[model samples]
Target: MSQRVRGVISRAKGAPVELTEIVVPDPGPGEAVVAIQACGVCHTDLHYREGGINDDYPFLLGHEAAGVVEQVGPGVTEVAPGDFVVLNWRAVCGQCRACRRGRPWYCFATHNAVQKMTLTDGTELSPALGIGAFAEKTLVAAGQCTKVDPAARPAAVGLLGCGVMAGIGAAVNTGGVTRGDSVAVIGCGGVGDGAIAGAALVGATTIIAVDTSAEKLAIAKRFGATHTVNAAATDVVTEIQKLTGGFGADVVIEAVGRPETYKQAFYARDLAGTVVLVGVPTPDMTIELPLLDVFGRGGALKSSWYGDCLPTRDFPLLTDLYLQGRLDLDAFVTEEIRLDQVEEAFEKMHGGTVLRSVVVF
Candidate 1:
């Protein structure tokens, strides 16, 4: 049976998200219905509202979520009703070449529910990142739901579903940050802070945070940044180099996703160091560098898709870390608001005052 629930939707490009009734159909084959408990307001949600992601209007926004399984369709064995799971956007197809090579993180054939959720008039709503959350309940592919310990707090650990995962993975998986490595993260947002925390988790001795906002930098320190560079008042590259003994950081994670910051990240790495770009970029943005510098730098430049995360492997482990109190996931939750406050959360997001404003049901 189809279920009716209240969800946040972006009806048109640049339209403010609206809280309205959405019809979520019962799970089809290989799918599941989740009763969303908490969903974080991510920049991607705002990007959908601004029409920056794509022209998929009437978008069911919100993907960073944690929920309990309410129903499962035929052939679904990954999760059962009452299981607590973190909703992942990537549902890897084992047949894909990436998966065949034992690297499902690079899975090229990720998937979502085959059936569509719709409005009262039957207009199909495109779920954000293929997991339309920000609702009382959501429908998604069974593979998109990664079960974790129910003991973990929903509002905090749910962030692992998206931005936070991207950040931490950028440092640990993509950049290969190791003990004693000097790491610098550009942006100081939720994602950047996650990178800082990841670097700290991996024993990086010098973690430098660069951002325009002093407030964000202060928060970054709490997240494990050993040093901070206020980009607004100083030259980013110069400051980063100075902090790294006039060389540069061993790994520089670019979480801002702009060409300028990308350049800073490129030049802010030590010789043969790695640069990881976890930030989402718009379609029209481009980066240009001297071909010689590309050859001269002689290091890896990588883009992190969902932090190159293997949800099934990473989610549970990260949750355990959180539960153990070693990982401060709770610090990421700046505030918890009702679903109706998502719009206000967006405004706060733009102002860069909070790390994450989670919607708690």
Candidate 2:
């Protein structure tokens, strides 16, 4: 039987999300139905509302989430009913070339539920990032559910579904940040803070946070930044280099999608140091660098998609750390609101006020 629930949806371009009735179908083959407990309000969801991601209107917003599996379809062995899971957008197709090569994290063809969740009137809804959980219940491919410790707070660990995962994965997986390394993260938002926390967890000795806000810099320190550079007042590249014995950080992560901030990240890293861009840039956004400088840098320049994360691997490990109090996942949750308050939360996102305002069902 199909279930009816309230969900946030952007019915038109640049329109405020509506908390209206949505119809979720029974799980089809290889799919599952999740009872969402908590869902983070991410910028990606706001992007979908602004029509920034694409022209797809009538979007079911919300992706970063944690929940319990309500039901599973035939052939869905990845997760079973009653399992606590953090929803991930990447449901890797094993037949894809990247997966066949043993790099499932880079699977070229990720998937979603075979059945569509829709408006009560049967109008199809394009779910944000394929696992829209800004609702009471959501349908997803079984592979999207990564089982984590049931004891973890849904509001805190659900962040691993997107921004947090991207940030941490950018440093640990993509940039290969290691102990005794000097790492710098530009942009002190949720993603940047996540990188800072990851660096600390993995024993990066010297962590520098660069941001325009003094308040955010202070918050970054709580996440384990050894030094904070207020970009609004100082020269970011010069400051980062000065803090790293005039050499520069070993790994520089650009979390701000703006091109100017990216250039700062490029120049603020040591020669042969890695630069990881986990920021999501717009389609029209472009950057130009000196070809000679690129050759001279002699370092890896990488773009981290979903933190290059294999959710099944990283989610459980991170959740365990959160449970042990070794990881401060709780620090990311600035406030909790009901589903109807999502529109208000979107306003605060651009104001640089809160790290995350989660919707708790």
Candidate 3:
């Protein structure tokens, strides 16, 4: 049998998201149905509505979610009904070349639900990032459900499914920040703050935050930044280097995803230091760095897709840290809103007022 639930939908580019009834089918093979408890409003959702991601109209927005497995299809045993899970986009296929090479985090063949959710008239809805949960319930690939500790609040832990996970993993996994290392994160939004928190969690002694907004910089400090640089008023590269003993940071994370910020991250790192680009940039945007500098840098320039995270590996670990109070996941939740309030939340996001306006079901 199918289930009908209220969900947020963007029927056209630049249109306001509407709370409408969506049809979710029973889980097919290798799929599961999740009863969503909370879903975080992310920039990606806004991008979808703006047609920034693609022309896939009628998008079912919202991917950062935590929920309970309501049902699992045949041949699915990874998670059963009643399991608390953080939904992920990458459901790694073990047979992919990247997985076979023993790096499942780079798995090129990830899975999503074989079936599609639809409107009441049976118009298929394109799920954002293949795992839409801006609704009371959602359907996803069984492997996309990473079971985490249920003790963590849904609004807090659900963030691990998207931007937070990207930021945290970009620092720890891609940037490889370590104890006593100096780290700098640009763009003190949710993702940047997540990177700051990750750097702190891993024992990085010096964590510098760079942002234009004083309010966001203050939030970054609360998330574990040792120093804050107001990017609008200060030269980001100079400030970062000044904070790092004039050698620049050991690892600089470019969370803003613009050419300018990327350039800042490129120049704001110490010699042989890592530069991790975790932010999503638009297609037309381009960066031109001196070829000599590219060779002279002598360190990795890596892009973190979903923080280069393996859901099974990272989600549970993050949850454990949250439950133990070692990580401040709750600090990411600025406010909670209902499903219908998502459009309003998007405006707040545009105004740079809220870190995250989560939808609690």
Model 2 reaches what TM-score against the true structure?
Answer: 0.99
Cα RMSDs of all predictions? Answer: 0.8, 0.7, 0.7
Candidate 3 lDDT for residue 34: 99
Structure candidate 3, residue pairs in collision: none
Give per-residue CA lDDT, model 2, range 1-361, as digits (tens). Answer: 9999999999988888899999999999999999999999999999999989887779999999999999999998989999999999998898999999999999999999878999998999999999889999999999999999999999999999999999999889988998999999999999999999989989999999999999999999999999999999999999999999999999999999889999999999999999999988888899999999999988888999988999989999999999999999999999999999999999999899999999999
Q: For each candidate, give its TM-score against the true structure.
A: 0.99, 0.99, 0.99
Model 2 segments more than 4 A misplaced: none
lDDT of 3 by residue, 1-361 (tens): 9999999999998989999999999999999999999999999999999999999789999999999999999999999999999999999999989999999999999989999999999999999999989988999999999999898899999999999999999999999999999999998999999999999999999999999999999989898999999988989999899899999999999999999999999999999999999988999999899999999988889999888899999999999999999998999999999999999999998799998999999
Q: How accurate is candidate 2 locally (lDDT)?
A: 0.94
lDDT, model 3, position 123: 93
User: What is candidate 1's lDDT per residue for 1-361, written digit by digit as tens?
Assistant: 8989999999988778899999999999999999999999999999899988889789999999999999999999999999999999999999999999999999999999999999989999999999989999999999999999999999998999999999999999899999999999999999999999999999999999999999999999998999999999999999999999999999999998899999999999999999999987777899899999999989899998888899999999999999998899999999999999999999998788999999999
Report the C-alpha displacement of residue 205, candidate 1, in angstroms. Answer: 0.4
For candidate 2, give the lDDT of residue 89: 96
